[model samples]
Target chain A: MTREHLRILLPVLSLAVLLAAVFYLQPRAMSYFGLNLLFNLAIPVALATIAQMMIIMVNDIDLSIGTFVSFCACVTATLVQDAPLLGYAVLLAAVLVYAGIGAVIHLRGLPAIVVTLGTSFVWGGLAILVLPSPGGASPDWLQSLMKSKPPLVPMAIIAATLIGVLTHLLIKRSSIGVVLQGVGGNERALERAGWSIVRLKALAYGLAGLFGVLAGMALVGLTTSADANIALRYTLLSIAGVILGGGEFTGGRVSPIGAVLGALTLTLAASFLSFLRLSPDWQIGAQGAILILVLAIRLLVTRREAN
Target chain B: MSHITTTTPNRAAGLRDLVQKPWIWAYLAAAAAFGATMVISGGQGAGSLFYAALTFAAFSAIVGVGQMFVITLGPGNVDLSIPASMTLAATLALKFMDSNPSLILPGLMVAIGVGMGCGLFNFALILLLRIPPIIATLSSSFLFQSLAIWSNRGIRVKPPEPLAEFTTGGAVFLPNVALVAILIALAAWVVLERAIVGRWILSIGQNLRAAQLSGVPVNLVRFGVYVASAVLAGVTGFLLASFSGGANLNMGTEYMLMSIAVVVIGGSSIAGGNSNVPGIWGAALFMFLIVSMLNSYGLGAGVRLILTGLIIVTVVAFASKKGYAA
Candidate 1:
């Protein structure tokens, strides 16, 4: 690989190896859990990571994705009972509503971070309106289907791989992708070039919405019941993954393909923490320490390069 | 740019501004709900709205004002650790009391000191390390939370019985705690408006590089702003502890989003340069009332989050729009 390519792929390779090791050590567990760690906890986490990484790449942030996930989950869980078809419809509708909101905010030329946060509140509010006490139930068969994990290769993992591949294509070869990278690099220069900055931003938000939707879907499956707090941590974890993994690991310009490895690595780390049997307090402390260490290292590396 | 119109904002302009802005409508809506809440909660009087406004106003205003400092003075920078700092300071102060088991007046010193220390901690990380304030504060916040959680271990500490007299069920016109918060607001107004240091803050916020060139002690001002904000948050926490009857680790996290929302919706630009303490105060009352309304509706956590997110988006989006326009 070229040097630039190596910078991107190295992290990816390391994470992939980590995942392999995790699987090897817990092969029985993976199998016992239907051969898909994605269905376990990583799926939602990975999806949230992708959502966050996309926005971070564009040098914007979203504090609302977590709530968005909760909002959609709550709605789906509530609607899923009694009318299975309508529940699916509600799920789709929620996704569209969130996406539409993202698009409007992007088009308005406001900072994505704050706007998304506000929209998150609205969506979360709507979620409360539907099911105030987390009483909704998922269809019994939907849980069975979700938990089944598709014998051939664990469908959720397959789906994630597909997303990673598509993301790879978009970042590497797409026209808007170039525009997005350009905007993040320098907003003024890009705007001066008459590049329709608004459209590009709207598209970025749409990608964020997609990732959030995927995360919500998987999180709903994992919990067997949707609640408001389900994916709240995902917002922080996603951004942390992006920064720690290699997206911001390279000032937010590393390859999208690498992000998958980054996501896997992060999931592995969390699983590792669990494996190590840390208490909840320690887990939180561990997360803080890990972020600080990674950031400190990244800053050191950047300074050395500057030197 | 100019003390957010210090001489009592043009009532006509302010009213005009309110009508034109959706957030004001939101504020009014929140007030209407507060009105309904007062009537339903068995507070039978015209003064109930005013009382409810005062009750919610001070804490939210204090935090909102703190948020204003971080964003405006620091240039769209956020101190995510405000809540953490507030909790740490509040908890530490109360913990100190628990140690000495002080019976009188020690609470004030302990609480304020803890807040200053927390603020000073935030100031050092952001200024000396030159880390982005948001990231630094966020990590510090988590660190603070871990420490708080570890220390508290779900334990709660309450004020001694005598101190409770100053806070709960004692006054109809004004709670003593509310008076303390008002004094804080007055002090902040002086520090951020009339003082030369205040001018330096606004100037730096208006243009950091220029301020640096002008011998404004850039690091000092930057650090001071965060310290100031921390002090405000710390005081808020201490009072909240008293009002709620104690201090706990989880209390401050509740303030983070709502506080930021109150500040942004109050019309301060995220990129900084809007000074209107009264606006911040008014905005806080409205936001608290709004949340209380939502709660009264028996809204679930999901709904609360979504609504908060939505409010944040609309308010900040509008601020950016006005900012760019101006």
Candidate 2:
């Protein structure tokens, strides 16, 4: 296969192998309900992966995403149900803050990682203030919407497909996406071409923030409650997902469909581990191991392609 | 312009130069935090507050020094595994010691050994797997943390009695832990300012390709730095566990951010190449003091966190603006 085709096919193949392994390990997981049980938790993770992909598209990373999502969920559970306008207003302000952060990082040449690291604390703090003890309930509509069953496939799979297709169109096929990717690919070239680098960065961050909000809401929809540190692990999970999906750290290269698939693969890997009766303590370590294995495979592939 | 006025101008210039130093901001912030906390408490507990800040800041300063070196290797080169390394080292060492006083030395060795192993693993992943340091360290930390949890099963193993006393006790009016940290800082300063290895790190951070072409042992230097960072983290974990009377699974959780924050707030360039050892101490103290100030003012965790974030952002902005001007 051509390198281009291989590049696209690798993530798909990995997902297929992982899913097959999971099903093989637990024959019952082949059914619709079983598949839903396995993949349902991946929805928020996929959303988070897409969100991280947006930031990476601009050659930046968002360490605050996990906490930001938790904040959004907290707002959704508490204010969205009680004070709808305030809830949305707070989330909007948070996104604008993200945009402002992008603008500042671009203008000042500050490191996005450190700035986001600092903001993680802010988001965590805000989340706690919003819902101190995690008692807020998801709106009935959201819970029902998340629980709704589809005809053939599970809601999780449908949502994953929808996210992949929509983001592919928005980021891969749109003009704005071109500009955004340009900012990461060759920032100076984009600037020379009369594009405002700062504006492009802000737009990317804003969009990522929007996705983060979606991820949070989706998470709360599934869990039906929220806590300050609920989705804190999503930060690393999203980064790992993005990488597993064939995304590079510095380059503008990203794959929406691949990232979603990557998220699903990770979810399946967890289920696969459980099916193997692996100890819960090692589950996290297995995640790290999987990430290492996938990256190692990519390295070998790149070397082969070079030959 | 007159000859008699030259002395005054020289003095003014000296003050200006000192003010221009990036590390000075951290000290100023530290002092401000101290003063605010003092004011809030009606000038009470000044000595105790300073001592407390010193005690807590020591751990952050130690980890910050290690992180500073890694970050100095340049962009996307942070060691996110510090917390995990600390937890693992502490857990294993404490378990090995089993609270026996004679085993303290052996336990320290075990902690250092664990640190070296973690560092080696991190470096191997980065080199062999071609994984970025941030991602590599992050993933490896999960493994380390898992090891920690698996071995201890959430048990909090107590330190040997004498070891705990040594960690928590004061010597010559200074906390022993603070003294140990100061010694480490001094050693680190000597390395960064006087050693060839430090130069290699700085040059590499400035420009990797250029540094490589200059025949710098880039990989070796990177190997040493990563190992050093893990070793320092391991030592900090050991000390912290002893000082706190035991090791807990989540004991290292706060240090991950604490290390990075101290590095940045200490006025070290986040972009790498440039760094400050004195500033780490100042930033570490300021971090602790600021928390104390916020708590004394009856602010909730949310407000304290928000203020801390805003303060870090503002400091970084000002620091960067100065960097640009210089």
Q: Count clashing residue pairs per candidate.
A: 18, 0
Best by lDDT: 2
The per-model lDDT (C-alpha) reads 0.67, 0.89
Candidate 2 lDDT, B1-326, residue by residue in tens = 00121345558877776778788888888889889988889999999898999999999999999999998898888999999999999999999999999999999999999999999999999999899998899889989998998998977888999999899899655899999999999999889989998899999999999999999999999999999999999999999999998999888988988898888888777778888788899889989998999999999999999898888878777776776576
Off by over 4 Å in 1: A1-39, A80-84, A106-111, A135-163, A187-194, A247-278, B1-44, B74-76, B99-108, B120-130, B169-172, B292-321
CAPRI band for model 1 = acceptable
Q: What is the DockQ of each candidate?
A: 0.44, 0.80
Docking class of 2: high
DockQ versus reference, model 2: 0.80
The alpha-carbon lDDT assigned to residue B14 of candidate 2 equals 70
- The digit string of per-residue lDDT tens for model 1 on B1-326 reads 11322435457786576555433533554556667666666665546556666776777778877877778774537777778877876677666666233643677677777778777767766665555677667766777777777666666777766666666643777756667667777777787778988788888888888888999997887777787787788878777777777788778866777677676676666667555455566567667666666676677665665665555566566656776776
lDDT of 1 by residue, A184-254 (tens): 67767888988766666666766777778777766777677776666777766776666555564213474
- Judging by DockQ against the true structure, name the best candidate: 2
Please give the range of 10 consecutive residues that has the lowest summed lDDT in model 1 chain A: A243-252
